[model samples]
Target: MTEPDGFRRAAMQWLEKRPDSRVDYSWVSSFEYEGSRIPLMDRQRGIRKPAGFEAALAIRTTFTAAGKLPPYVDAIGDDGLQRYKYRGDDPQHPENIALRNAMKMGLPIIWFVGVAPGSYEPIFPVWVVGDDPEALQFALAVDEGQRFLRPDFGLDEDTRRWAEGRTKQRLHQRVFRSQVLLAYNGRCAICKIRHAELLDAAHIVADGRPNGHPVVPNGLSLCKIHHAAFDHQLLGIRPDLTIHIRQDVLEEVDGWMLKGGIQGVHDTRLAILPRNRLEHPDEHRLEERYVEFLAAPVA
Candidate 1:
């Protein structure tokens, strides 16, 4: 689906702050049941209550960063409820008071159950609802857009066509992670590190956005520190798949450690090379970025 321009911008900003390193999702289930001592009957019935306020806050924080809202919010009705009103000159106006209320409660902007006041038994025991300026801004934007396109929530044919094109262009970084995992056999390309916790898919080329494309040829599999170094141009990989050390950096103590620890040994060949040569870095792109690296003053 085509997201609004403001939403797209906000999404990009949130994504940019995300680290290039990998995160282990394998242990997520363990943490889900932590510190819970509900009765055996409740556990057997799978009737775990909703998370506490702190837990909900954490979930919201993650969802916002991921450029999405919680799925639970999608249950508000089209007619709206309570202080929220869905019917007006611009019923589908994104900025409707009801829309704001739904979003504020982490509900979906679309029609669903449980969003209307007094619709069902309270699933959430904790009342953690507080003012969030970001959510408020999103609500306002939706409201204005709805008002502008009143009566019909759908965009004009021309606008809809344009949105379709934009939707295809929005790259999900998760795809890159998958590509890296497949390329390196799920191991860190450098140091032959097999521990999943220490491995990451490093971008051989810079991130594709603001003119970068998230293509396989532009990525690599390195650990967290190596990924940061590659991004900062603190490290470079030669076309021959050898590691290239900045001359000045070669003399520093930390640099020496890197050289001996990882960079020094990995010369002449890649620890984990892509099976498809076409997916490897473009020689020209590497050369261009490498030249820029050489021009930087030593710190």
Candidate 2:
């Protein structure tokens, strides 16, 4: 699976130059190498499911690059069923010998997963681990959007059930964050922080609460610290869009993180709003959760 000399080297150079941010399919469209000859994109960018990925993958990855593997190609199987296995560089291409050497060294290879043309960076990943045949199966399990399923993971019944349950929960969290982040344009609603990976979709109503549903209106994009505070009842968002820190938490003589990051912002207006008012947090949902926040023992 060798091609032009610097193909992989140049492509990886592009990836490395990108901001140290989570790579998500929705965040970017496509990246080009050497202008346009080595382009990184799923075949088409509109398909929203795994079908889209498979379609785009035909052109997205290692085929013309070093390993000739698709963007999401499975790890080398122990069953000896691998096709397009990297067979080493063309003897005429001396530079490709280095690429071959690197492959022999077992570097961690990752592929971004999401709807493509891969114009945007990916938030989700498919990590390739040798001998872990379930890597792809488990990847699709958590990526409910991809709707990947594996009926033959070889796990016992009970273990499989537990794994499925955990995967479903992760899927919900991922979908919830994707929606809330897009709604707020990737900024925390309270702090206005814009790092996508650092933000989370904080549930307004607890997920298992009677009326709780995993809809965008029931979520808020909060930074890691704020999401933790909100979930622990140390902070709350009012129906009127004000911040509420637990009285004791506000009064406690705590460190700068507490004062500047949380308590200090109490009662201030929320910093950002979704472009569509209909996408705003549901007032009734917020009210229900706020009551519990008021009732919780002070942190």
Candidate 3:
């Protein structure tokens, strides 16, 4: 699906700030219910929202985040529809009922599955695109992305096509970027530039190299230019968390951008480390990848 429009996006940003909750689906039955939806204030404050299905959008979702694994979200039809089941055979399950009401009112639903580790919440927006509920009023949700309530839900295609089209490497790259961005707080580790679109999570070791996994410690948030430089060995990071510019790049004649941006900085402490030492870059991987950087052809 394409991303939510600007108005919706802006509203979502405002709604998400200081989110009231982490998203538990159980709150639906347990929390106060008015008009068959949680009160706006309570929903925003993260109160109880097991049956989130709010009449609006927030960072988590209109329904917000679902705890652990949602009991619903059971099946996807061959033609690209999401099938949500009620617990056991309870026809009047609160979740099922609320979903039916929303569908009847034609209100769209969005929710978070779970936040990936070291990342912010992910959103999965699905509407009642179909009406084949086994029991009356059983709700159906479909982004049909064959996907997640993740940061980049926009890339989701229908489950069938998505599964058919995406590769393991591409999936890893998208998920890895999100994880690295969260750990590094969405800035370039070297330049400390804060533009999110320009940021990249670079692998300390090359992708698919021996022992190179795309986990947080193995990734560094780098801007596009630095990512290229590091990949090409124009830049190197040491085991001790210092930056090194290859001598040729430093000494060769160059433009202002090359001088100030790339070649000028040498032996600087890696500018952006994760807040938690545990999430910081791995020295062992740094040691290994540095060897590859050193051996890179000096162009």
Candidate 1, residue 239: lDDT: 64
lDDT of 2 by residue, 112-214 (tens): 4332222232322222112222232112222322232333345455655555455436544554566677778899988899988799988898775776765
List model 3 lDDT by residue over 125-172, tens digit each.
Answer: 444433434543232344444333221133245544553333223334
- Model number with the top lDDT: 3
TM-scores for every candidate against the unseen true structure? 0.42, 0.53, 0.53
**TM-score leaderboard ranking:** 2, 3, 1
- Any idea what lDDT model 2 has? 0.54
Which candidate model has the greater TM-score, 1 or 2? Answer: 2
**Model 1 worst lDDT run, 10 consecutive residues:** 54-63
Off by over 4 Å in 2: 1-149, 152-161, 165-172, 195-198, 208-214, 255-257
Alpha-carbon lDDT of model 1: 0.40
Candidate 2 TM-score over all chains jointly: 0.53
What is the Cα-based TM-score of model 3?
Answer: 0.53
Q: Using TM-score as the measure, name the better of candidate 2 and candidate 3.
A: 2
